[model samples]
Target: MTTNGECRTNGTRRPKPLLSRSCSENYEINDVDVPGTPKTPRTSTTPGHEKCTFHHDLELDHNPPTREAMLPEMSRSYRLLLESLGENPDRPGLLKTPERAAKAMLFFTKGYDQSLEEVLNDAIFDEDHDEMVVVKDIEMFSMCEHHLVPFYGKVSIGYLPCGKILGLSKLARIVEIYSRRLQVQERLTKQIAVAVTKAVQPAGVAVVVEGVHMCMVMRGVQKINSKTVTSTMLGVFRDDPKTREEFLNLVHSK
Candidate 1:
């Protein structure tokens, strides 16, 4: 990590840590460390310039209510944002908009407040079953870190259990914990796989995310039909072609 809080790898700057300290310490979920430039914090509160501060600004902890308490302050920034748009924020129609938007923004990024342990809640159970377990078509919604627009998707997770299995719903809960934050689909997919691996020490884990990013449709290339797919395969899933093919077949099937 650099002094400015970004990551350094192979003499190149990288993006911020993919996982928070609480979650990362337990799960070690981060896998990719691609090159990127360090972003300098800007005081500008204009649209697209403002973002959720979470730990960087507040040294956020596990308690989400603490983050929730910052809503009034967040709303102040939102009020400035409305002013930056040259709109009448005080008008009755927009009078409550700042705080309302603040609530929504904070809720949208609440994944910053979650840790894998909270999601699991001691849900892992010992089982002699060693067959592949698959959960598919888990709906997910997330913010694009780059453009801050929405990317909605479905995630399919699979793991070959060793001595333990997680509660079925906990898989979707894992998806929720990661997808609720500002993210790239690539990291989100890997994080889910890693979290599962850590929870169960599975023989292998596989995750696939199929996302339609609003950023592509609403801006940039304006490619309305574009969808992004990213996947992460660990352990046997990465090493065994047949096993990987089986997981992919399961994920892609209806």
Candidate 2:
């Protein structure tokens, strides 16, 4: 019962869809001579097509990568690093080592995703008690900026609050914000002092950082028992010797 460019489907006959070049075009099936394949003479319909044609471009740009996307590149770099060190990355024992190390390295430097303002989160309080409040023996861990090795120990902070005091827990949180990044001890000490000064505008601020840098202890001189101490003194702690001494003495006291 069907006739003249009509097709029957389940006993129904409809006019056939008109096939234009666009509709009939096959995006795949490009008759190009691929680099590794045998070169066939070009057909007129596929003229000037010498390069391989892929269904989609594999280039990446524009968007920021998610943690999952970044992991593969980090793992690849670690594998390349192993190869550079003349170690076989594809060995049975080392097969997943790159992935494990990538995850570990990302965790170690996770502070890059944090901000000082975000960490503070309105932890400042209106207080008129103007005394030297000291927080000492705060555990700190940081990667040395130069060698990307660990430098960990204790941080001691003291500040004379003018009108505002930070919530005690924020002190440790602040230390953690800066300590988790790649840093130099001197810069880290000064950054913590400056952050406290900015947050509370204290009468004075003092910070002392004592660390055993693996960059120094594990390599490059390798002094196994050596320790590095860096300090920052601002405002009264910088100008008044007695205030500085008092802060120092408190930090040093057991």
Candidate 3:
């Protein structure tokens, strides 16, 4: 006798037994012997026979928030700090100050997010010109690392090319990168010089900064007109008096 779900093999009907249990719920099924077809036997349960199913196609979704999404919240906290400092955040003049300040700060401190390599990408060119190249009077605004007060300044850079010269704008960019962070003027000047020297492997590098620190003028000494000058001289600039004098004279000339 053939079962309803059984099929014939070699044009002969095969004997198969019908069971009340289904494959989904059954612990086991009996093998049915049939003519011209071999029977498939089921093994008895061993110690660790556990039912398992194979599945295909698994996926994951991941998303991260952007800087723009988080900046507004940070600006709000800064605005609250301003309000706590006894300033009215709702005043007509101050209404947009917080947002503006946040944006300006983002611009000022953008150097932190930029790499020196990326900033000077392809900006360096091979040049046999060994003369001093000076770019002067680049404006800089930074916060004092000590007091977080504003310090505005001018920077002048000069370098003697060994076999490479950087783009004029890149020198200013180097200054901006160091200046945008909270820094001591001395360290900022040295960092700029060191970066330029390393980037171009120049024969010499000199950096000079003249700054008016708000902390000094607004609170400490209160000397409004006093400006601090700091500089770094490397390689030939340190050993050669004529080279150093040329750099200094050009920087202070105007």
Among these predictions, the greatest TM-score belongs to 1
Best by lDDT: 1
Model 3, residue 143: C-alpha shift (Å): 1.6
Output the TM-score of candidate 3: 0.68
For residues 5-65, write the lDDT of model 1, one tens digit per residue. Answer: 4444456653332222233323334434211111343333535534534332222222123
Q: How close to the true structure is residue 209 of candidate 3, measured as C-alpha lDDT? A: 91
Runs of candidate 2 exceeding 4 Å displacement: 1-64
Model 3 C-alpha lDDT per residue in residues 13-93, reported as the tens digit of each score = 422211222322311222211111113322223233223111010110212233355568768987898889999888898
Output the lDDT of residue 116, model 3. Answer: 66
Listed per candidate, the RMSD to the true structure in angstroms reads: 11.3, 26.4, 30.6
Better of 1 and 3 by TM-score: 1
Better of 1 and 3 by lDDT: 1
Clash tally for model 1: 0
Clash pairs detected, candidate 1: none
